[model samples]
Target: MGRTNGGGGGSSPSSDSSRKFMEFAERNARLAGRLADLKVGSAELFLQTTEQTRMALCISDPNKPDCPIVYCNQAFVELTGYQRDDIVGQNCRFLQGRGTKPEAVSKLRQAVETEEYTVVDILNYRKDGTAFWNAVHVGPIYHEDGSIAYFFGSQWDITELLAARETIVENERIATELRHRTDNLFAVLAAIVRLSAKDTDDAAELSEKIERRIEALAGAHRMSLTGEGLAEDKSNLRTLVESVLRPYRNSHADRLEIEGGAFDLSRKNITPLGLTLHELATNALKYGALSTVDGKVRVDWKETEQFVEIHWIENLGSASERLDTHPPTQGSGSGSRLINGVVRGTGGSISTDYRPDGLQATIRLPIKNKVSF
Candidate 1:
């Protein structure tokens, strides 16, 4: 009876051991099934998030030949004007067009080959053949083994932003140009007022002189700014000179002689040239050649390939007797300084000669190529 009881005890222990083993196995199986469900749910959530995002997203399979696109979200389709079916299984380079920069393409290509992240502002075309600037961000999606699984690209249409930036730059440029022009105009006016005050203490006389000088400046400004009905945005040298001297020519046409072939002067140089000529003529009428009858002023110009040389000569005739009175002090006055400043601004040079006969001036200015405003 003792042996049989012992054998029964042994059998009961073996059965208990087997039962515990089965229970452990069952617990492990249930845990595994729960873990699998969790993984599937996570993947589905990721896919949903990507699909719903506004950012244009696309996935290219590197394992596939040529790394063609395998997945693209709805936003990508809308941005590129391509259907999902048409986009899938094609390389992303199809978006490139003639305007696309080769440097950008090379950078993108290198990034993909080396599994590096990169961003570029590249020109791209849509399915409808319209061009747009695309700011693209691309990087590698790696697998758990630290190997590249896919290349992920996100793109944004930055065409409008780029256009706005360009417009701002252009506006700033125009503002700068206008400010420069205003400053130059004001400088010339101030010089005129200061110099005119020195010549005469009479307010009426100074006023008349200032008015006439201002009118000459205004004429030049009008011609330079408006082109004076010329098709091009430039003035003819002869035309500008004749117009500036027109006031002096009215009373004595024989006293002023203008001789020059047609040479184009850029609008930028017109006002300065006009101002210089006006100062010279005013001096002549006051104390030089134009102070007496039979005094003659001859203006002429010659042009070379790169420079236009202007000559202004005066014959004092009977007025030569008064040469010692003024002594050709043209280069030592405020008017002379103004002339120098404006001429130098145009990249030109001027020289004055005080002879026993009269005053002579020579100006050489560069002929700049025509540019569109």
Candidate 2:
């Protein structure tokens, strides 16, 4: 005060501060009013905007229908085949039939009592006796004082989804059991191969090998009982490719190498694949590169999102003969029609490229298997 001076700049700064505070207060008041309006009318807003949405919805009084259903949308009515008049004011128990589980009801009760949100899969009936899987979600509504109000719920018909899950579980169970049985079978087969390998004599060795192979044929048969491919198989795509060439493996005395990832396939196709491989092996041993020494075979199978391609390549053999070199006699046996029949029967395509390098069979089968890993 002793140094007091009247300054226009100081007075102007104070006025500007006052103006800014007043403006901020006005904006905050407007925002507060809008938030209050939305908080009070959110339920009505949701009903007006999203009532016709595909997701089934219902509004009910949690405190009180017998367990009252206050509102149900068109989707709910259509899914359950109930008219508004038929469902409104009534307990949802009308939708419960023989399929309803008491445990789910207990959970629902617990949720309502605790004012907690609950999501559950429940069995419900339609207007017809047809039962369907219903996914129900129940949550508590709160009043201004944060006291429990009624309940809000949503129901979705998951009958198809539940059915699909069941099917998958069944398939997985079969796959697991099949894998165990197949593992035992392969153990026996590997032991036999080792036993057959014991004899060093060429002719006897070959004969024992062939005998062991004949025993391996039982693998497919065993798989047929339970329906699965080899347990040794680890890749679904490779299993598919191997199915095409498995019969051919060890069919030739010459080295045949299977190169690729592990795949899993069903027993449905395992038999055919085993049989096909057998046919190819028989042909190779009798007339193909395996008939001679210095001959080797390499099998490489690759899978992509769009296609699965298997390739069979045989190398130059000591008994090398041109692929065009026909047999002395053109006699027709199962040999003449085997590969063509199998491929054509499945409506798949086969292309054979016979070169001086050996026989290269490229099989392109469209990807139709829907596999879940």
Positional deviation of residue 346's Cα in model 1 after best superposition, in angstroms? 4.0
Q: Whose lDDT is greatest here?
A: 1
For each candidate, what is the lDDT? Answer: 0.78, 0.59
Q: Highest TM-score among the candidates is held by which one?
A: 1
lDDT of 1: 0.78
Assess candidate 2 and give its lDDT.
Answer: 0.59
lDDT of 2 by residue, 130-221 (tens): 88889999875544334444567889888899889988987898788678556645654554355444434587756755474555457445
- CA RMSD per model (angstroms): 16.8, 20.3
Instruction: State the lDDT of candidate 1 residue by residue for 1-373, as single tens digits.
Output: 0011111111221343345435545765786688687776755866898889999999887766677888999999999999999999888888999999989888888777655678999999999999999999987665433445677899999999999999898778767656766787888888879877876889998899789878888888787766554234477888889988998999869999998777878777788888889878888887778887789899999988877888989899876754656632375675677677778778887898878788899987778833211
Q: Which stretches of candidate 1 lie over 4 Å from their true place?
A: 1-43, 219-270, 277-335, 352-362, 365-373
